[model samples]
Target: MQEFAFELALCAHLERPDRVVGRQLGAAVHGRRVADVCLVEPGPEFDRRAAVTPHTIPPLAIESDAGPGTARPVAEAFDCHPDRARAVAERAVELGFFEREREGASTAVRQTVRYPEQWFDSLVGIENKPDLDRPGDLRDQLRIDASLGLFDEVVLATETYVTGAHLNRLPDAVGVWRFDPETGEREVVREPEPLATDGPGIELLDREPGRAEVRPVTAAEKRRQRRRIAERAYGKGWRTYELPDCERCAPSDAEPADLADARLPWCAWTDGLVRPVADCGPTCPGYEPVDGGDSDGDAEGVPPSEGPEAVRARRSAWEPDPAGVDRRQAGLDRFL
Candidate 1:
């Protein structure tokens, strides 16, 4: 089953490769499930809180074979069967993750609430932005539980799966956006760091109580860490798939690669802008994805692709984009 594919790819999908935009990847396990991972430049970052709230539960709530505390605890609250452990554990993780994120958001909101009226008056930036006072190298101690892709990495269970984006209006502010499956809309969330801490280092220093300055993570550092985690996860061989739609490559086009290119828009793939997946859908034309590179299955039992060559056309091979499209779109569309 590609059951373990998405779980493993969770990390990599979050931290896509470097300068590897405008590419789509589908990978799988045992030819069952897969994950559809795209790298693209999206629109401005909106208030995720303002966006539609995700109805689909996250994976962090499940009970694991490991223990009670973890997302996947050993046996359920009851002594459930071990065979059913994985499924149960996985579900728990998803839900627990949603809750954990909610709790963190709540905490951040509380901290923000404590800001005095005068503080808010002069607040060009968050004076003491959503601060997290963990007692260790938080960046190093991310809880990467039930590791499917890579090991020894920090795991973040935000309410939404990120699309790795930037806020156009606020060029300096980077956004990690996602199309929340539950809400059926886009949402953007904050990464580890943004504002500088009022104190020095991980160690705390005396500062205004309510006016504390939570240190935000650096953009470069944030990108680097995310890339590392994603690389480690993609290193695994589970399957991966996409929800559908790539705005640029045109999923509705008569071609396959353009539809799935990460550099494109989500609609290009899912919205029928490009040709549909030949093998899976109805009215089957029945052609294989010649360029369907490195596939890894997700919960939906699809696979991922590999490398830029998947979308490129060769003299002897059929170009994934059948309209005799621009070769530059295959690579340069990422700027969009």
Candidate 2:
């Protein structure tokens, strides 16, 4: 099976029980590679409460000769004003929520933001390798993950048959799993050893072969890094698959629970989850036409094209809302 298929099945399985799954995430920590699949547990009740309530203090506005901007109270661009916004900004500065910057003429400003930190309980990283025989840098990458100790747990999810030799090469702390993409079956070969997130960590450096250097990370730094990583994961979930704009394949017709897990909309007509792309459309055997009003028809004046490049161009027009809902009705047509 292809790695994409394996990753998709894994994502479907992970989405169960309300775990958030993100794929191909840009590494939040510097010097780390992009994670193949990242699973983050929901944050605590405190974090959820904080997310719903806005900051009591309003952001400070910075008016300049060029234009208007907002700055943290500590920023050089931050000129004190006797307003409520200033009071809140000033308090935030005192609380160490803002990092100050002073530029030559225009003071560069930065905002130290806080996320729903309590909402994220743990981060689990998975490396998908469909063919272990063609392993390239797999061992090194897992080792780096182990040494860096960024994720609470790291595991290798592969379709390849596990052997004693393969296990011997990988770090004992890292977990191993046998995955079957077709059946969505997963078997755990080794349970991962939980890494210490509350304490200081060691950042690994690929300085020399067999002689990796390490840097000490303070607990405060780790906390900040964890938040950054979790925020990215929240924005980029594993539901990267796009829905085909077919009249017969209206998302509302699909089972919401099944779609949430599979990332593929279920077609009751087909009695299964149809491919999000090519397998959908009027020409398909299971296609059942609906009102063209909701379909991406030529009523919008844009002709459809089937080439890969054209498909990519079309996909770019759609964007996922923060809540992961597909708001197809957004953009130019809304104006009409």
**Which structure among the candidates has the greatest TM-score?**
2
Local accuracy of candidate 1 as per-residue lDDT tens digits, 140-216:
12211111121111123233333333122122322233332222233445432233312222212223547632233
Error of 2 at 289 (Å): 13
| lDDT agreement with native, every candidate | 0.24, 0.57
Q: What is the lDDT of residue 18 in candidate 1?
A: 24
Tens digits of per-residue lDDT for model 2 on 1-336?
Answer: 556656766676666445556688654344666789988776564344233222221223212111112332233344554354445445544433443344455333333433233767789988889899999889878876776677899999999999999999999999999987556678999999997778877666455766866677777767766665655565456656665665544333433342222334445566555666656777787676664454322212234223222322233211122122121223523432
Error of 1 at 44 (Å): 31
**Judged by lDDT against the true structure, how good is candidate 2?**
0.57
TM agreement with the true structure for every prediction: 0.21, 0.59
User: Stretches of candidate 2 above 4 Å error?
Assistant: 46-71, 74-116, 207-214, 244-261, 265-336
lDDT of candidate 1 vs native? 0.24
Residue-level lDDT for 57 in candidate 2: 19
CA displacement after TM-score superposition, residue 229 of candidate 2 (Å): 1.2
Write down the TM-score for model 2: 0.59
